[model samples]
Target: MSETTLDTRTVPHDMDAEMAALGGMLLTPSAAADVAELLNAADFYRPAHQTIYRAAAALMDRGDPVDAISVNAELDKLGEINRVGGAPYLHTLAASIPTAANAAYYARIVADKALLRRLVETGTRVAQIGYTGEGEAAALVEDAQAEMMAITSGAEPEEDAFFRSFMPQVVAGIEDRANADTNLVGLPTGLNDLDELTRGFRPGQLITVGARPSLGKSTLALDMVRAASVNAEDPAPAAFFSLEMGRNELGERLLSAQARVAFTRIQAGTVDDADWARMAEAMPRINAAPVAVRDDVNDLRIIRSVCRRMKATTGLRLVVVDYLQLVETGERSENRQQDVSAVSGALKAMAKELGVTVIALSQLNRGPESRDDKKPRMSELRESGSIEQDSDMVILLHRDDFYDQESVRAGEADLFVVKHRNGPTATLTAAFQGHYARFMDMARG
Candidate 1:
């Protein structure tokens, strides 16, 4: 389970006590499928139970008789299915327990997985409760509606009601704000220029940062990540998928950037005494930050699952994929481009579904090197050119020092806003302190 990539599609087992009583038996296939669907929710937990339920659902969905044998067979189809126990274990559970009398026991087995039980409870809450349109039916609906309004209105409680009541005006105010901005995302990094360009990379937006090799794409991403991690306004908890660079390599770069020391000097520990003191001082500050690193993960499912876990634990606000080209799209197809396309689409969808801002590093196309200006445009996003079309915003990085010394002598590196779906293209020059591996606003320089 810990070795391979995470299967985001795998169902979780977070069914509640009421639903767990059904186990793999319940009302049969339909129940299992519903249970599976609920467990896959972003806020859901108990992936194990979800997995078991999905196996049962897929089996039942095959149009076969809903029985223990069929459920076991379906479990077999879900390979690498490790949970200390398998379908036979589930079959044994179903055969051994009776729902009417064993509700307590059923709940006990899945007690540790809170989300799993809640998923089951969600189904229980909605089952057999269809709407009615007339007479008593209409009255019941009105009563329910009134109760809902009362709860959500946030008004003072009256006698017999211990809780506060909801106000319609307040509800309307919130609704208007949401309607005004559908792309509300993780958090702002406080970089005025960047924030103004994309409204702070809100939830559901797949933001791409691209550049030719060694043009500091990852550095720019790190700047954003670190700033967001340390922000005060709805600070985003971030996760990074680094397909390149080891823990030590990345650490050194960050230290150099934060401490404003030459990266090579830090790496070699041959720096002047003052620089060494600065490095020591920088360690504690950067280490105090809450950025979590997962050096090993290649599967989209695992990434999603881990991210969901991170969100549950740390109030996740953003996710960063070091390089899009390295992630496997779970499709064992021969046409690599199509597989990559699927990955890109899935990433954007995941951004929206999870309501977390996703930032992916991309490789610039080769066409720019041959151009007269050597500045990247949207067409430079290599391999999957569609990245330009899918991403809400694209930041192209260029260091004129890579070729023109005169440009560097002038003290400039240009961040070209190649595509701003919601705003106009603008360029911002930042001081490129190559020795320190840092970028500071040119104004400071």
Candidate 2:
């Protein structure tokens, strides 16, 4: 099409389809349910059609018949009779279609046209953004991608399947599990006991790992990443957003943990020959692992953008946020609790949207230290507004040696599963090797 023709073209809409859908619903009240599944008021291009559709939906919702008279009455009740062209328009719609059986088909057509219109609008907005050059080029691109993602995700047809329709898939999953050697599902954390108790971390799950300072929360998160990516029989792609640590620091920690070298020695630049050899041996596996790390970004929007990109490009299965307190929501609230709450909620939403397991590190408040028992509680999560509520699982790390150097469980850590939405809560013990900057299953240790 020529430029002028393209510019002059009307926005996408099918008046015939809209009228047919409405007529089908009015003719066959039962078809209202089918049409309602596909189209909403906003989907109609004409305001009158939108009003009519709303009236019909309201009548259906209230168990009232959805015919021309009832719909006209509904419009009159809402003081919109004149706006929708009076009773004549409702009668016209009722006779527009030959059969109500095609209501869903007409609704689908209307939905497609609405989706195309939205795409056109999105393209125009993106072009405007490009012309304005109002923000950083990278941020602008992120915004554009986000807009496109929203359109595409919203355009997806929701499946309203009954329980009988879902049984086949559920039974298949059960059979798969029964045939498998291990009962572990989802991504493994590499800790045998924890994996047994919680199964693996599932997609769309927001897992919180909380601890006081120097308690190896970050180490545990890295361990999970390593297990899922570098150490798995079939490695998967993973992402780590380190707001607290720099790229170099994370690399050093990962190397130390994977190589079983003393973190102190690596930090102090006192690595010996054996440590070098171990690191050399671990290098190939680390290089082969498809793990992406971002240390510069702190905003939750940018983090989510990166996750979406990774999910699209690499089929990302896991995401780890190093210590949630440092994450910003791009819009600060007066109350710090509200800010943290927003970040936590966004992280959870991101996990569900991207279908990835998100392990977010959190910090515990001083409530643990004030009590005789230094074990961190779910209530002690710093700015504990919605973190507990948002997370699918809340793991509180407690190392006895952190409080008492001479304690019996000196080299062990207790992972307190305070909140498990899908399973029972329990405390699991694992070997905490501080020197190596990693955690391991006690049996393996």
Candidate 3:
């Protein structure tokens, strides 16, 4: 074919497959259910096929008979009988296939063609956007990626495994855990008590760590990242999306924490011989760890896109969004609460979609300061009700010395697991080594 002819070719479709699928549905009720599970009316390329499929689906949904006669009458009632070639065409479809057992297979072919058509449409739209240069380059790229992701995600088969199908895997997992040396079922945080209480952070969980200003919520989250990526017996890839702090600042904090060097000394460029030695010893591990840090982008869509790419490339295990309030969804809402709600919901969805544990640091309201005990609570999560609703777990952080300098628990911090959806809620204490810019388990300290 010539280039012009190829360019002008009709979009992908398999009319035979559409007819076969519809014929199978007309032959048997089970075939109709099977086809419906894999495809909808839009998957048919022909308008007549679309109308016929819709009529049959409507009849099936109402528990009515789904034969050629019933479908023809239904289409006629909806004034679409002539549009779909009347009763004779319905008979042609019923005679098109020999057996209904292959209905799902035929539906699969139709669905695949529909997916390709969607892909072509998405490419056309993206090309138009590129031609127009209507938005920022980064935003446009993100929008294009979002469009492609939507098509691929929609094409994925629905998970319809029976309960019995899951028991074997569950038993295998139990046996594996029983045989393993560690008790952790998910990625571990370095803080031993918190890890024990939360059973580490499981996949598809949105764990919110909330604290007031200067209480070291960022420090705590970074410590978890270090644990998962750098300190574990078998370290996993991790990502840190720092919206409130710069990359350099985060690097300094991570280095100081890992080396047990003073953060102030690192900040002032006054590291002495001992600090230099510790940092040198820690450098190799930090460099080898598959940890990605991005300090520039705050848009949630871009962040999610980067994360999805990372998950595909490096097998990302944990994601840390340093404080949730600063994340922008790239769309303005009527109120700040709504914006935060959208951001949190997207973060939760990203965690599930990527199958990674997400530790989103959150800023707490002033509820702690007003209380006599100075302990943060779940209700104090800044900006939105959805934070608590969306999160699988919520940890509230508090430090004694932060409130009273001479208190007995001077260097101790309390992490209250206020909302653990899968486990009991409790408070755990850790050593807040502020100078080192990290938290340590009390026993280790």
Q: For this target, which candidate reaches the highest lDDT against the unseen true structure?
A: 3
Ranking by TM-score: 3, 2, 1
TM-score, per-candidate, Cα-based: 0.61, 0.66, 0.67
Of 1 and 3, the candidate ranking higher by lDDT: 3
Model 1, TM vs. native: 0.61
- List of clashing residue pairs for candidate 2: none
Q: By summed lDDT, which 10 consecutive residues of candidate 3 come out lowest?
A: 1-10
Give the runs in model 2 whose Cα sits over 4 Å from its true position.
Answer: 1-157, 160-167, 443-445
RMSD to the true structure for each prediction, in A, is: 16.2, 17.7, 17.1
Specify the poorest-scoring 10-residue window by lDDT in model 1.
124-133
lDDT preference between candidates 2 and 3, better one: 3
Regions of candidate 1 where Cα sits further than 4 Å from its true position: 1-186, 231-235, 408-411
